[model samples]
Target: MDKKLLEVLACPVSHGQLFFHSQTNELFCPASGLAYPIDAGIPVLLEAQARPLTEEEKQA
Candidate 1:
């Protein structure tokens, strides 16, 4: 993912900062407890597309 693009990208629902998870290819919003998927290098920032984070993932 491009650093510049990532810097400007925020959670669509909460408008919070996102942390990229390389292993899962997802962008996580700690504040929202959501993980937005990245497919083909494109971030699917839609709230409907986001999945709730597991408790373990939250601690990580």
Candidate 2:
């Protein structure tokens, strides 16, 4: 992912900072406990498309 793009991207729900998870190719919002999927290198930032993070994921 492009650093510039990532810098400008925020969680749709909380409008908070997001961390990129390379293993799952997802963008995670710590504040919201949601993970937005990155499909074909494009982030699916829609709230409807986001998935709640598991307990393990939140810990990670």
Among all candidates shown, the one with the greatest lDDT: 1
Any residue pairs clashing in model 1, and if so which?
none
| Regions more than 4 Å wrong, model 1 | none
lDDT of 1 by residue, 1-60 (tens): 888999999998889999999899999998899999998999999999999999999999
Instruction: Provide the lDDT at 24 for model 1.
Output: 94
Output the lDDT of residue 14, model 1: 85
- Give each model a TM-score: 0.93, 0.92
Model 2 regions more than 4 Å off: none
Candidate 2: which pairs clash?
none
- For residue 12, what is the lDDT in candidate 1? 88
Best by TM-score: 1
Model 2: how far is 31 from its true place, Å?
0.4
Deviation from native of the Cα of residue 56 in model 2, angstroms? 1.6
* Residues 3-32, model 2: lDDT tens digits: 899999988889999999998999999899
Summed backbone clashes in each candidate are 0, 0
